[model samples]
Target: MALKITWRNILPGCFKAKSPTSPLEPRNQVSKTNSLQRLSLSDISNNGSFFSASDISNSLIGFGSNLHIFTLKELEMITQNFSSTNYLGEGGFGPVHKGFIDDKIRRGLEAQPVAVKLLDLDGSQGHKEWLAEVIFLGQLRHPHLVKLIGYCCEDEHRLLVYEYMARGNLENQLFRRYSITLPWLTRLKVAIGAAKGLAFLHGEEKPVIYRDFKASNILLDSDYTAKLSDFGLAKDGPEGDDTHVTTRVMGTRGYAAPEYIMTGHLTSKSDVYSFGVVLLELLTGRRTMDKNRPSREQSLVEWGRPLLKDPQKLDRIMDPRLEGQYSMEGARKAAVLAYQCLSHHPKSRPTMSNVVKALEPLLDLNDILAGSFIYMAPTEGKKDNDDVDIIGNEHEETEAEKNEHRNVSEEEEAEKKEHGRHQHRKGYRHKHRMRSFRSRAVYSDTALYRTYRTSFDNPKLQGQDIVN
Candidate 1:
């Protein structure tokens, strides 16, 4: 049934955005490195991946992708000829403009706001990147990954359309100057959502490694639900006996895995290391590399990693923007997880699924802690101890919460002894991370190849075909 699409419905309430091409400062467009000195031109552009626009157009039907094929003229009309008022912001990819789509506009595309990304032909990324996004986001769907609605590939022009994320990227939300700081619970929630997205990729049938997992690529919806974006640098993970994918070292400088930068050994663990960096950014409210800070404090991982393990040192590194809002336990656990994920040894990092398990328990901690007065800072003379004077309230934690925390502590201690070398000292497997916010296991670590999936059907559009 085709719903009536009125002009009023086309420009929704949020569509009245004011602009002269720039509203908020655009998110930082970090430079992506080309392959090493030995690689040829084809290798640097990831031509080996066979993701040409024409190639995708011919094979997309077989890939089972149901994405709409939009014409350039259709997009121009929706975006008001790429008007300045409709312009959202720019990134490394290209300038994005706000647009609307409905069944009236394209038959199968739902009536909703969208962001149209016009590929900058002369810019850093090109058709290969565009095709990668169309293929990856085309076939793979998850709650945490952004929805790629459709695309236009016409006469040397390439564009991608995605669901408009209200709050924009995590980089703008977390690091934008003069913006409201992200609360502790909200940060944890975003972390969990982003981690789930990565977990879904790594847990897929042919495991995907999101080559670029940085703050700017994680967008938030109106509800603040984090969704992974930008599949430009994404690649399939190694299979069978293969341990790692050797590819061009292409990723933003600060977020790329050290081992990958050193040897081009791309693995799911590389993404984990990047996640750890973002987690650290969330905890500290700082960029991975901030030259604005003192020379000693510029590199977040360098200055912050040492403080994560020591509960006493944890507060010194926490985001001062939080204003003593996070519980000591919650903060410490997050730091420890960040520490483990930032492990120099790839094998020492926990999987994304495990990262999700660890983050889930933290969701409820802040609410209970704040309301029950369980997370108050120690008063003068009680500086060394964490025992908080209880407030008279029904918000107090039940005995079960205490027992659960105790059990988690015991398990952590046992795992501590299993530490192998310097790298393994911080690493632990999946079992220890999930100790239950609600005391329920929600993920499967044994899912070798995406056995653990929540079904989602991409809407099939029959209106147009790709212009090859």
Candidate 2:
């Protein structure tokens, strides 16, 4: 009989291997690359050939036939011998370079652009991370998930190939100076796309916890459609009666769920918490942690959570660059959702599905206008406009009426100022310089592309970071 093999059998100690024996004992740190290497040796033994290309190709779990296994020579040619001119950006993994592949190397595939990410042998991430990305992205496919085109694993060199995201990541768009400000509607749309990706991961047959759900990991394509990338820290969720998976804490500091950070308990809710932080960034255009900012304002959650519920303070917390283009009702509802996700108790947070539902209506322009009109409807035939005295005479409208009038005027004035600012900004484009954040280095080429292409595509799609 032919020897039967399954993913579990091929990789006996996979992600779902076993829980730590003791709460206090450190979890096993065996690198995934080592495990796969051993498995490759076993495959060679079974096939009676060392380093047989066909056998090696068929040995990878779930990825054997589906993904293209590129040779080091092939990638070298695609990236023009790893020229610096093609450099994209660097992350924990290593420096990424832009590349192109034609029908010659990939039969039936069209000539297209791609981002090639080479693993830094001495970087913080290692072979295990490179493998983790392939395993997770190889199996998971969604519109909002970044596409993993292929990978290169020959000798000591490890690399990944991905679809080129023209727009890049949310981090650069939201915080990078001189970047095109994402309008309220575009921001809402991006949020919904990202939330759907997370929801799909959380609601999978075997739930996946996206341990890293920060702005840097949320990429955008040419149309400003957000997609989640960098699955190095992704983990399988709990099984059966288990409530949570216990693993060593690993994630960006400000974006990590407090419960996960405190106790090493991983759950779908932990990803929800991180999503909330990104949502806040979209709303406020502020970094989660900025040492350059005032000490009290550095932690975005701690400082912004209380203000989310206060309508009067909403303007103060919102991104000034937005210039009052958003609907008040939509802002309020989004703020409420963010508040729930950032709750101190893990259970208090909404699931990614619910988060998606809550955001959908917020993007409806008609609904926002309708809700605003109803909220501002005149009572007792005191017309809505009667509250404001244009003659500059002090007539005591009710406190509510005065507040409403002030808010309207503020929004109108903001719009006018924003228009004027845009006109003035056009003249300074040539002198623009990208300011880098200490948290993540900005690649010069990527910045140049963002600046040059700001007016090329739909204005809404221009800003953000692209990953390899």
Q: Residues 269-331, candidate 1, lDDT per residue (tens digit)?
A: 999999999999999999988889999998889999989889867767877655555656778
The C-alpha stretches of model 1 lying farther than 4 A from their native spots are 1-64, 366-468
Highest TM-score: give the candidate number.
Answer: 2
| RMSD of each predicted structure | 17.1, 14.4
Estimate every model's Cα lDDT from 0 to 1: 0.69, 0.69
Residue 347 in model 2: shift from native, Å?
A: 0.5
Task: Give one digit per residue, the lDDT tens place, for model 2 in 1-468.
Answer: 222223332222222433323422111112223224323211212231112222223444333325676777899999998898887677777888888988788786668888888999987678667767876786677899998888877667888989888776777766767655776777888899999999998987667888889887888787779999888878878768999998888888788888888889889999999999999998898888877889899899988999998876776687776545466778888999999999989999999999999999886644222101112334456665564332224334566666666776677577667666342121121111111110112223233345546542211212122121
Q: Give the TM-score of candidate 1.
A: 0.67
As a whole number from 0 to 100, the lDDT of residue 375 in candidate 2 is: 26
In model 1, what are the clashing residue pairs, if there are any? none
Worst 10 residues of 2 by lDDT: 430-439
